[model samples]
Target: MELRYSPFDFTVHEDPYPFYARLREEAPVYHNEKDGFWALSRHADVLAAFRDDRRFSSRNGIRIEEPFWGPQAEQFFSFVAMDPPKHTRMRGLVNKAFTPRRIAALEPRLLEIARAHLEPLLEGEEFDLIDFAAKYPTDVISELVGVPESDREQVREISFAVMHAPEEGDGQMHEGSTDAMGALIGYYAQLTAERARRPQDDLLSGLLQVSENEDRLTPEEVIGVLVLLIGAGSETTMLLLGNAWHAAWKHPAERERAFAGRIEDWIEETLRYDPVSQSSPRTTTEDVELHGVTIPAGEKVLLLSGAANRDPRAFPDPDRFDLDRDTGGHLAFGNGRHHCLGAPLARLEARLALTELAATVADYEIDEAAAKRVHTSINRGFVSLPTRVTARR
Candidate 1:
């Protein structure tokens, strides 16, 4: 089949994996002339590109196309869009705050947050998982980043606005949402300034307290990192959680396996089987040859995480959602220096969310017709999922 991949194409959203399989098998280094980007779909190529950061640089920006008309990577995305040693320096500054121990300490608080969102649904048989997925992570990440509970609504509102930048017929970003970006950054500036002054017991305060005696990120950098964390941790985890629930509803055997004694396995398989973060975009620093094709330097290359996760060469029976298979190699979280820092927290949230969900429902029926997939090229998950639960006695 002829290959064409458009980030704005929502038709592919419903079942892109089938198309992704075709990309991996037929055109591993698929190029899109209209949008002017290359896609690396095979698992091996994606992993290699991720490891060779020197060749496939992230400095330009992560999105295949710039999100706006102006400068983005440096100002908007913080370290994610920057390469080392700048990436290294910035990550080192914030790394202390996101350590496993720090994230583990939030378990009690995260559990509290999850339960707060899930409690109301326990009483009702017919409810949507989207509400729980959307609310829990935003609150947890907000509290962790020092956004006051009162301001979380504003933070989340701005985040959703930014993530859903209006798509033109070509699937590129619309110009109108620049104000949302300003609103988000301006909000973070106020929060960071407060955290610096008061020194709250939160991550933002922790970043501020980093010794200014040595290498440290600027105030703007701190705000940039915090803003990225708020949006990345919230919506992505919501996608993971919603996808996990959707997987369980679709595959009864996997649900039974999770409830029986393999919740983590179920989550891992769901990540591989139906990951939310569908792709990671990188720009080639120089001309590079791969899979019999040489992509010129400076071109944007999309690592199809959703496609690579299901690459049959790496994953046997890639289409089947089987908890029995090993998922350690999955690129749901990209590989190497740029691997997602919030992965531990996202995984923790998924485990807690799924464990609670499995324990609460004796069985659940998903209203597939009512399920609304979020319309975006980057992530794949639901905006709404209507499910009817049979509470366990």
Candidate 2:
């Protein structure tokens, strides 16, 4: 049976692992000439591609082959799509903004936010985790980035537009598409200017403080970083929490064990089982041959991190979602330099959210009919997951 892989296909979106497994075993260097791209689906190949930044670069926007965003769009995301030196400098400055201390300091508030959103629905009644999961993380991160409480909803709307643009728009740069992006950047730019005038105890002010030899990010770059932070930090985390809950609900034994004790294992196993980010786009800088297949330079090569995580060559009995399995080093978060910037914060949020779910809800019933998986170019998770939670005695 020949397997076909399409990024925009709903069937593929609903479940892509079986096809991904075939890509690993049959066509490790799978090429989709129709979509005009190539993909590396195995663990070794994808990891190598990530390490070989010289050959496979992120310079050309990381959303398949997308014309490397126009000048205006570039200003808002150039740092993400650039190679070292430029990437290094931008990352260094941005690191100061997203400091360990900053995230650590926010833990109390993070937990509080998680509970605040969760407490209202923990009465053992039927409620969709998706509804609450979507906004809690966004609210927490937006406040940290200095977004006004009044504007968080607007920020979230923009984030959703950005995440879905690949599917809704031309899948690449198009006129008027940057309007939402512009709104997001304009909002952050205003915040950035305000921070410059009067500093605040927030990420925006921290960015203002991070200077390298009198060098600083332009307002555009700061806006870029903030935009990326909210977009990357919100949807992925939201879906992750949802995916973890859905995964637990599928595995009763594991769910039972998780309820009895720790939920960290559940998070780990869920990430390995159903990652939010199925792949990360990387463009080939030059022609490359892998697993007896030749891929021309400039061809978009997606490191299918989601597929690689399930490779039986790297994992034992890959299909089984076992909590006891040592799922350490899974590429649920990408590998190499472009590894997820907000991984620690993501883990912390999931820990708190799942821990609360386990503590407050005795057990839950998933209405699979109402549950819908997110169908987008580069995202995966439940869009609507209605559940019936039994109140804890």
Top lDDT model: 1
lDDT of 1 at 157: 79
Per-candidate TM equals: 0.95, 0.94
lDDT of 1 by residue, 65-145 (tens): 446312467676788888899888888888876678878988998888888889898898899898888888888888788
Write down the lDDT of every candidate, Cα atoms only: 0.83, 0.80
Q: Give per-residue CA lDDT, model 2, range 3-117, as digits (tens).
A: 7887766788888998898888888888887776688898888888888888988776555525433333345455677789888898888887788899988888888888888
The collision pairs in model 2 are none
Off by over 4 Å in 1: 65-71, 174-177
Residue 37, candidate 1: Cα error in Å is 0.7
Off by over 4 Å in 2: 65-73, 76-78, 164-178
Measured by TM-score, the strongest candidate is: 1
Clash pairs, model 1 backbone: none
Error of 2 at 165 (Å): 6.5
